[model samples]
Target chain A: MKLSDLLETAREDAPAARYTVDDVVAAGRRRKRRRNTGWAIAALLAVFAVIGLPQLIARPAAPPATPPPPKAGPFDLLFSSYRSGDLRVGDPEWVSLTNQLASIGREVSPGVYRSVGRLVLYPAGSVPQTFWMSHPKEPAGAINGHEASFMPLGRSALIKADTLLTWRNADGSMVLMASFENRLSREEMVRLATAFRTTSPRPARLPFAISWVPSTMRLVAVDVSRPEAATALVTPDRPDIGFELEPLYEQAQFVSAWSEPGLNSAPQPIGLSFPRSTPGNASAPSGGIVIGVQRSFVSGTGPTPKCAPWSGQHNVRQCVAAPDASSNLVARAGHDVPQADLERVAAAGRIVGTPGDPEAWPTARESFPASAWVER
Target chain B: MSDKEAEFREFVGGQMEALRGLAYLTCGDWQLAEDAVLGALARLYGKWGRVENPQAYARSAVVRAAIDETRRPWWRREQSHGDAMPDIVARDEILNIDDRVHLRQALLRVPVKHRAVLVLRFLEGLSVPQTAAALRCPEGTVKAYTSRGLDTLRRILGADLSIDERLEARHEAV
Candidate 1:
């Protein structure tokens, strides 16, 4: 009984600790209020726009006496597939391409060639949808991986200026194989697949359309002019303009694994809001670009930003559509900075001047494609 | 003061240190235990009129809060807990400060729920029923946890230390 009494004394003698209930409660209240404010702002914007005059609405377009037929292209359908992070010589990287490109899962560029096509094996497995390069010649299947595993087929040439390998997609588009052979592998095919998987694409800024080629490794063609400029896409010869290359993310400060697997991220900043036009016309879509900083497990993958801020235009500014790829030919009102500054911003990741073959660089000029430039 | 508020103040004054002790055993860090208890008490104050027995309610709240903190974030762990076994002694040795501190460090490494049961059974002098009431568990659970906690404590602290030595270390710390 005496021992029991003493135990109570120890229990009751411990000192009480301190904390703020108000702070926790206050944080909760702040979160609730922020949600409420968001709803209120959305409602106010809706009401204000609704109350605006009929002057805000634009009239319909005058119908043409004879509508023109849809224009066909002199363009190559460029498909993009990549492996991100440290894809040692035998791993898989996720690959995504413009809907036009299909991963037929086999070495052959499907349908383009009859059964006489070359057979290629991919570490992503031998699926039938893995087709990319254009075919009509000798049977050759080229397998590569980047942000994910890919099984493309092609022949490649190395840029005499650098070790960057250039390959042709089965479809004749250009691709550059990034050199990230940091790990050892017993399987030759797996080693080749992994070498492809660890590569990253070039800087694809907004006001530009980046198309992929698999012939060489890590090459991208930028179309600042879109659809119409598709005809002006960069090729091995006959460049339409003189341009340069810049590097936004230096090659040394990169890791490949962080952007791998599902590439699952919280609300990606790279967004393409489809453009809107009047009832019959195409939509005029606009969006913002953010400076991207990519961290991964390899060296080849580099930084590419979307919609980086343009000088003087607090917001909306039109990208010029030059019929010919040479220099900026269009200008608009309310733009604060010179077109030259806008040109420099567009050149943010380029290396400048001709360093190698015109095919080695995705731009038509073999330096920087004027077709991909935006002006102030 | 209204009767409910006055009753709450008196009840809190009575249970404050005991609840703090329970929290300390759960979290091992005196500071975090204090925060857990104080937060629990303030919430108790808001429910002063409705609670049936504020002490038990607050004790349960402190235990739950301390456990949650242990799982989700840091609760100021004793760096020594992982390296050296907590100090414990045979029933024959004289209780000392060094032994008490080492024992407390080792006790902190035990599972928080297990430590709480040990504190309630031995440190608080709760009968099986009282400990169950405070923990909002059945008396059978209290007994099982008490047995398991003692076994784990003995295994962790070394077989030389007996229940009496642990009680004496508590006395030395006080």
Candidate 2:
């Protein structure tokens, strides 16, 4: 039997199957709409939080009897989860700098890492959650002409219970408070208070400002009151630089950022089990940021690689690269997807956009997305 | 939640089944697809009042929600909704069942770009132009995908698929 006859026979045999198309289409379209609405709502809430959050975040109208428990002293020189038994003898350089600050009452504690011996440098007597930095180390080899010096820490927000904040001094010496509740996680602030020989103290009103856009992984702002006010410096002695945050403040009306040099990124591949994704079979690199598909492809494996040669695997996939030159790549998109769905994620991005650099903006069309090749 | 929640619940009752089927096609996993549909319907329930094309809006919601559900870090920890092993032996019985399994297998083998087209064209019975309109792709792309999909299906189903292709040509001439 030919193709049409086969289809006709199939249709005659299973008239119900005809509905599968409409069913799948309707479901996909609704689901996508549902997701976009959720994201829009979530984003709106985030924006609202930014605007209306002042009230919630506003220091309590009635001050607490005692300020929250300050974080422990800067315990830089963190140990490796795989290697170290003690926090003192670790490899990360940020740990070393933190340890030096700790010698003089600076405070630093790990925020989020496997075995981070974090440091929170603080002034003589102040709240610990003031200034903060995760493993900040310089890039090895000939460094780029960028500042990796210290600036005073500014405002602090309790992103989590254990996490704290701190600021760098103008002399570029790290200073500020990092707070922690129990001992689960501590900030640099407690370390500073101890250095000043204070039993307990809570510093308030951060000395700086920082902002991040998920669309771009960059933080920009300045510590208006840093003591030394040196350029942000990078000093990764060996390979594998640690987290060094710098300002990328640009004077713009809409929104601008002070770019911190160096790309601080990890493989954020989302572990998506596409019907097409096989067991232990290599999947073509793919992923994209659509209106609703945040962290596409599941989050465990991390973000899909954007470029390099590869066949598109899943419709939900982002940027994909082929495994081989001739390995056939067959991207299977369901007919159910609305025309708008394809255009939603396939927007034409910049030829090359640098991460953390807001200037490298994605030229996205609000309505129709122009597809672009993502070959890194 | 007072009045709005009740109203949304009523609206969801109407759209749940259709949404679930669509979700199943998208993920190819029934339970996950149902969850995705529920999640989408729940969200739709929230905005039932403001939605213009409630059904269209719901459809979009399902597609995008399923997509996001695929993105979570925890999503990796989960895959199939059930542990039913694939039935390779009982796959090629009736053309419909065979077609479903065939399409599913071929779809799994096909790249996303082509698969979507196949689903839109063969399953959805959308004309090339309708598919282009639905996919927001150029007509050429719809045609290209149809051609490419047929070729890929040929490879996966081998001889079985060829007979079907010949049938399709005969039907088109008729």
The interface RMSD values of the models, given in order, are 6.6, 8.7
lDDT of 2 by residue, A201-302 (tens): 221111111111122111111111111110111121222322322111111110111111111121221222222221112231122122111111232322
- Clash totals for all candidate models: 74, 131
CAPRI level of candidate 2:
incorrect
lDDT, candidate 1, A272-365, per-residue tens: 1112111111111121111111111112222321223334334434233221132222212123333443333333432222222223334332
Query: Which ten contiguous residues of candidate 2 chain A have the minimum total lDDT?
Result: A253-262
True contacts kept of each: 0.15, 0.12
Error of 2 at A313 (Å): 99
Instruction: Indicate which candidate wins on DockQ.
Output: 1
In model 1, what is the error at residue A301, expressed in angstroms?
93
Give the poorly placed runs of model 1, Cα more than 4 Å off. A1-376, B1-3, B74-95, B159-174
Q: In model 1, what lDDT does residue B76 have?
A: 59
i-RMSD of model 1 (Å, 1 decimal): 6.6
- Residue-by-residue lDDT tens digits, candidate 1, B1-174: 578656766776677666777777678666667667766776776666688866668877888777665765344553435346854545545444345555665676777777777776676655677778777789889878878877777777675434555554554454
